[model samples]
Target: MLKSWRRRCRRKTGGMPELTIPSHFLCPISLHLMKDPVTLSTGTTYDRHSIETWIEAGNRTCPVTSQVLRDLEPIPNHAIRKNIQEWCVENGSRGIERIPTPRIPITSTEVSEMLVRVSEASDESRCREFVAKIKQSAKESDRNKRCFVANGSTKVLSAAFAAFSNADETVTVLAEILSAMITLTPVLDEETSSNLSSEHPLQKLVWFLRFGSLSARRNAVLALRSILSFDQFKFEIVVKIEGMVEALIRLINEPICPTTTKASLLSIYYLLKPTENSKGIAITLTEMGLVEKLLEMAVDSDRSVCEKALGVLDRMCSHGEVRERARGNALMIPLLVKKVLRVSGMATEFSVSILLKIVRGDEGEEERAAAAVEALQAGAFQKLLLVLQIGSDEVSKEKVTELLKVMNGYRNRIECVDSLDFKHLRRPF
Candidate 1:
């Protein structure tokens, strides 16, 4: 029976042996023929994409041997990749497609030369064309992005390319530069960010965001998120660029794509993290009606979109003024209650957090008690009880408990709060 099965398999493979990949050509992690192979310090080879994903997830163990990853550096297995390419070519007639040679990532010398050429470009179109090339190359893979950043691309681009704008149609070059700038964010150093921003040359990044093309706006906002990721102080400088805040605020209200909206929200999220004169960043966001914008987004069909919007709202509602603004918006309370369990666990956590903060409002504030009453009258107490009864994460259940306690105290102020409801709501504990 085994001999007959082997004969049949050989016949199916046209007598060219089984269609088996050489063992060394397979990535240890994926157990598939390697494309873009690289070797880790554990002396194990993997496809670049697989290992990069593993490392990006914060995994420090080798997937094959369960050995601790002492270093993340992956040396490209160029020789093995070459052999795989040749093998694929030799077997091309039998259905194996030959993989093209992967483009070599930019080196420090190459990027420096490119930056010099970019600086000397005679026209905005020429500058943007080069920058677009850079952006396209960087986007090819994480390997390429890391290579570009490690090769001094961040410093070169920040100093030279950020200022390349056409007098008549400056948005394109500026946008492309910003787009490329963000790609190097993963490896950006604190000194690099400060050096980039202190030049104040990229404030044009902010200015163009208002009048630039949609592509330009998206790139600009993303770049802002990247630059500000390194230093919170830079956010203050960014918001100081006139119309920048309002423009970012306007991005939320615009009928933009999810990617752009999320970028805008993250920019605002970081900007709101730092305070001045004891003033919270949410004041600016709320004054510009950001709560309503986020509330609208909270009902988005996309789970991640809703999660991010709710996250921003959670932070915003931490401030009293923003909380009052959200209440005034009317959509905030209902949307918050509705998404409690409907979206991701993250969304539920943030939604419940926002409500909990509202319930535990400012000390000696009479309006807070009134707001809690209105929330109960809005059926929040019932929603909390239902959430506890249905069961949720420890975090969510704990939050529900705190919320029930706060609402129970407001029972005298709220006619809708029932004594029997307290027993059910608190039963989760």
Candidate 2:
């Protein structure tokens, strides 16, 4: 029976001889042989990657035993790692490769000392060396990033950036500092976020977006997105910053890459989110030609880009000025109609909501009727009916039903053939 099992394993593995992995050598979280095993406070061993991912996802419990973890720190289980290494060596002919020893994760103390070194450096060359070291440590792993955040690295980096940003000679060091700051953004605590959101750091990021390398600009936008997500009050601060909105809009207008484009979209979406202060922001964005840019992106792109572009347009169109801007665009109605039921459900909903807002005519019933006629001419009537027939989420269905009613009156205005030209039409029948 054992031989038979080995033969079956060989067949499945494309002919490598089979060797059983010791049950103890497997991580409870992954059930794969542990590469770098660590012991949690719960006395359970898990692969470092698996446990770190779990902890990073905000789970405080031991994945296997369901016990709350008192200590978030994972102690390396050297014995199990050694045993796994030995087993791999013994099974060398069976194609098992030994796992290399994993580097130790940085501790908060190490990160804090590194920040101090960068701060106390007396010369530009020494500062650049220290900044490069910090950036390298941040790039190494998510765990190091968390360590950096925990040590208030964001505040330190912000101060460092402000000090060095004026010196064109220290441009390399400035870039290095910005790169490290970006990694720490993902895990920033409230204190760090507040420090980074101060006027100097915020302006420096805007500067980078405008003048930095393409890679630097992408990092700058990502850092902004992370910082903005921390609090709603920061939106007021950001909108007031000179060139902040324009920088984000320019990225969408001439994207460095798809990633930068999406980041910019999300950043704008966050800024224009409905709040007491955001109404003016929508008007600002619309005035800056953002409406035209979003329409162009939504007209044709990958599903993700389409969804995000339409989503921002949906939010922006909530304001009267924005709706007017969208209405003036020749492609607005047709683009929204095309996106409906063509992209994902969220895209469909956003497109429908924007259409509903545009055609609702808070401006005047005459304007609303005119827009409905435009949608009808653009084949929105057929698309709405198809959406209802195919089924959709409650929001989309409700909006589509409302649109159908509005456009129903204009149905006769749309020109259609009186009869089928069967002479050229091909039919299976």
Candidate 3:
């Protein structure tokens, strides 16, 4: 159907004579043939879509006239519309066809009123209807979304979400709308951010992670990420939620999809970064068995997931409790060894950093030797050699050398750290 329309509009002559669109028929806003021409209060005529868009963006002046518009209503210029229609039919021999009547745009006032009605909705089914309509409007066009934002849809959505007294059935619908708010507006206002934070929206978001559908859960995660980016205080508040950390850990352990997996990992990773852990956030992560899950994720086939997983692993492993946690998990040593050259260079760096912390003996010499013996048994030497020949930067090289030197002292316990390999390993130092 689309191809036929394009073919009909082309000129048929061999020289391909230019299709001259009438100057008066063009919309000043888009410079295309006007379909539903409308006259503004300033007496300038524009295509309905173009002028409606201009007005919805908070502009009250005409695009062509620049006169301050007196009223919001745009009067339809039916005479110009009929004339354009006649010109299109007259040019139908050149494949041009009459334009179909355009659908009237949903008014900004209508959007604002709908949002107010949604916020004031009393029950689950009613909220669902409003959510569907708002999501449809947002999905219609970026223009509609900007208009919605201009009328303060984000605050209304957050307020409706925060004021929901019954969370059991409304969680899914509320989260769906909140996620739409995220997708529509690139950034949330500080007042909205403050509202969500004070109202503890993170608790509900964490709930959606476990109870909502895939789309609901995905959007919930995205919404959480946006709030967490607000500032350090919001991050601190979210981490303080009773089960928020565990929920992120659970998502990482049982991923619904790679995109959500990355989002969950990012939220957890940010929480573990250099905050005052007197509250034991990292310790809680370790206690909840995050280290083992991270080790598994570090070897993921997706390079980006693997890099982020390794990044979190590196941060967690640097903590005393988390370091001890990784050392105890038998799979951690070999996976770290295997991931060295298996993923991206960033993953390799993080993997090596974990081993260095273990092998360097902050936990004392016994822990260091135990780590060395474990790595040797896991074929750490085999993989380390591959990394050294390929991706290892100077810092990684030095760390590998230090690990091997530590392992060299424990060579008698391990079979793989043999005499011949030592010759190649020592040459680089």
Question: Between candidates 2 and 3, which one is better according to lDDT?
Answer: 2
Candidate 2 residue lDDT tens string, 389-422? 9898787789899978878887787762223435
TM-scores of all models? Answer: 0.67, 0.71, 0.63
The count of residue-pair clashes in candidate 3 stands at 1
Model number with the top TM-score: 2
Candidate 2 local lDDT, residue 49: 92
Mark the regions of model 3 whose C-alpha exceeds 4 Å error after superposition: 1-112, 115-131, 165-176, 186-190, 232-243, 274-289, 300-303, 325-356, 369-429
In TM-score terms, candidate 2 sits at 0.71
Q: Which stretches of candidate 1 lie over 4 Å from their true place?
A: 1-93, 99-133, 139-141, 161-172, 184-189, 230-236, 274-289, 301-303, 314-324, 338-353, 356-367, 377-406, 413-429
Q: lDDT score of model 1?
A: 0.73
Q: Rate the local accuracy (lDDT) of all candidates.
A: 0.73, 0.81, 0.75
Task: Report the number of clashing residue pairs per model.
Answer: 0, 0, 1
State each model's C-alpha RMSD to the native. Answer: 6.9, 6.1, 7.3
Best by lDDT: 2
Q: lDDT per residue, candidate 1, 379-416, as tens digits?
A: 77877888888888787899989988887888776578
RMSD of 1: 6.9
